[model samples]
Structures are given as structure tokens and as C-alpha cells.
Target: MRNSIFLFVLSLISFGTFFQAQKIGDGETVDVNGLQVSLNITNKESVQVGGKPFDRYKVSASVKNSSDKSYTIRLTSYPQIVLDTGIVELDCVNATGAKLTSKKIQLKMKTQMINVSYSAYDKSGKSVSNVLPVIGSYYFDSGDIISDNAIFIVPSGEKPEVNVRALR
Candidate 1:
């Protein structure tokens, strides 16, 4: 039928129009100590979560260790989300969703939170921080844009390994 042919042509046009579509935020690299850290968001798709729809994005953190010895450090993503009110500065400790390589270096890809839900209230019911409001559990419209930066945290030793007995 003519309708079927028209549908096929429409599909082909859509593919040709966006054949080389890239992620929203990509092509960014940084150095953490002696390691190379590259961050990118890809595989974007419209998904539904908790009775709400969202455009979810997958984040990839590729770390390359050039040093001979393996380094032990955690990757903390500091996400700055732009909300309708203002930019919400996600805390380092509270927003560390995934921990990076504790042994070797490689690609650490994970699905990020699309419809992130959080209230700005402490146990005492006090508004401690500004909220990253989610509109209707899906669309996150704000004045500022959401952005992220990765930090390499050098884990501190639990206890001193000094020879206290020997010194005594």
C-alpha cells in the first residue's frame, strides 16, 4: 500500500537525520593524580520510573593508570544540578553514587539517576539544603543546567602503622 511505503520513507529520513547523534555532555577529560579520567554521558533513552517518564542517560567513567603500582582511590561525582530555583550543589559524600577502581584501571560505566528524588529536610524536619526538584517525577526543568565533575579521593589510613611497641 502507499501508506506502508510512506512509513518506510519516514523511518529512513529519521535515521538519516540523526545518524551521528552524540550525547548531551561528552568529550571531556581530566587528570586525577597520575591517572587519566574521562567522563561522558551516552545511550540516552526515554524511560519510565515510578509512574513517571524520564530521559535517562548512562555515564561512563574511564580511568587509565599509567603508573606501575596500582592506586587505591574512590571516585566521587560532584553533580551540580540546575533547578527551577537555582543550582543545587550536591555534596561530595552524599552524592558519591558509585566508587571507582580500588585496584586497577578500566572503564566504569553505570546507569545514572534520571528521576532523582530527594527532599531538603533533615531528621529534625529542618530544610538543610536546597532541593533538586523533579517536575512530575520526570522532567527536571531548571534555570541552570545539570553538570558533574569527578574527584579522586585518596583514602586515608585507618590507623598508623608506625612501630609504637618498638619505640616504647
Candidate 2:
């Protein structure tokens, strides 16, 4: 009876540890375009795009900003990619021809769907560019710290559109 009880207690402790590691919830708020936007993050077993498996440690972030003020936000997944040729590569791209080779890249929130807003002016005291909504998929070989950021332009005023399905 004592052995059985010990096993049961160990099982409970293991389960509790697993549950505690899985965290999902709303993240911090930031000024995107000209509006205050909130971000939501959720954990998933895997993330699929176009029916292709992207990553096992998958999470989704929902952004809320504006349609004005040009800015770029970026989301990074913690994983490293090594090509079969033994070359390490990181790919980041956007519709506007913006691309980056590092593990980190900046995304634009220019649409009204994502929740980015404009906020301030530039050094020239002119209204900043519109904010663009960006969706990013990261490919890595190992687990790392996953983080997302909402960037805003000075003298902000624009709000961008974000697509919900893209995050799925």
C-alpha cells in the first residue's frame, strides 16, 4: 500500500510540473500606430501553415494597433537552422521587400486588421510612415527563447490591418 501511494504522489507531481511549464495568456501592451494595442500569446503543440508543419513549440500572438504611423514589429522563434550543407541560415521576409538574415527581424504593421497605431513625429517633425502588420514563421533545430515585439514610429498616427488566419 505504501509503494502504491508513493507512485501516485510522484505521478501527481510530474503532472503538475508539466502543467506549470505550459503558459499562455495576454502579453504586454504597446503603442503601434496611434493607438494602444494589446498582444495575446498562446502555446500549441505545433503550428501549421499551408498544411506544412512549422514548429513544435508554436505560439500565436494577436496584435491590436492602428492604421497610421509607419513601423515594424517582429516575432522570433527560438530555434536554429542548419542547412544540409553545414551552413547556418535564418530567413526573414515581408511583402514590402524587407528581409533579414539574423534570428531577429523587424515586421511592419501597416494594415488595420492587426492592431498597430501611429503615435508621434519624426526628427523633421513630419508624420511618420504608416504602421504595417506582419506575420512571421521561424524555423529552428532546437528550443530557445521565443519573443515578439510591437514597434512604433514616432509622431505616430497610422493603424495597420492584421490577418487572423495567418497566425494559425
Candidate 3:
């Protein structure tokens, strides 16, 4: 009887540990390139730019993957940046302060690098017009995570400004 009770208690402890390991949010998995990708965003805060009494916000994006297979993902901006000169650019920035001026961009895991360059051009060979700055970076490994904070700064004056701070 004592042996049976001991066995039961051990089994319960093992089961609890197993459940804790597999437990995740909503049990949801993201499919990426035939593999499951897991991502999460936290520490989100929004504020008006320059206290101009305008509606502006800031969000921190955190992405993660726990699958055994490795995958590559690119963090990209939703709306393209429109410059005052009527040029639409990708709005990507690198550690060296280089900007990516492309339309469609991709970041791969094999290379573990992000390359953003010019992609489209008008009849005059000039870039299209965009106002937002490039706001994305690269991720190389699974279970590997990256984060960035974005801020939209709208001055109280006649112009609206957007500021981005990258938190890797």
C-alpha cells in the first residue's frame, strides 16, 4: 500500500511538470514556412507626440519561436513612409544608420542578416512619396527573440512627425 501511494504521488508530480512545460497562450501556433512560429508583444504604451493634444501611440513588438526547426522572420512596417519629396520608401534602418528604400523586402534566417534596398521607381526614376520611416529589423534563430519600440511624434505645429526607437 505504501509503494502504491508513493507511485501515485510521483506520477502526479511528473504530470504537473509536463503540463507546465507545454502550457502557452491559447495554445496557438503560427505557421511560417512549414514550421510553427510563436510570437508575443508586451510593454505597450501610447502617448501623444509633443503633447500636441494629438492622438499618437507607441508599441513594443516581441517575437518568439519555440519549434525545433529554425525559421527566419522579418519585422516590417505596415504603412510605407512618404517623404516630403514625394518619394515612397521602405523605411528600414540598420545598425550603421543606413536606410532601406525598397517596396517588398525579406529577411532570411540562413544569412542571419537583413538587407533593405531600393525596389521601385517612377517613370522619372525617382522614388515614390511616403511619410513613415522604415520600422523593422531581422531575426535569425528560433526560440530567439527580438523587440523594438515605435513612437509617433506629432508636433503641435502644422506638421506631424514620427519617431522610432529600436530596442533589440
Top TM-score hit? 1
Each prediction's TM-score against the native? Answer: 0.27, 0.19, 0.25
lDDT of 3 by residue, 1-168 (tens): 999999999999868744433211222443333333232223223334333343232323333444564433444454433222110111122111212212111222322333445556789998775443454533346565543443333222322121121111
For residue 66, what is the lDDT in candidate 3?
Answer: 47
Off by over 4 Å in 2: 1-25, 32-37, 45-56, 66-105, 109-168
Q: How many residue pairs clash in each candidate?
A: 0, 52, 14
Candidate 1 C-alpha error for residue 159, in Å:
40
Candidate 2 lDDT at 56 equals 25
lDDT of 2 by residue, 1-84 (tens): 999999999999868744433222245444322333333434323334445443222222333334333232334442323222
Residue 142 error, candidate 3, Å: 2.2
TM-score of 2: 0.19
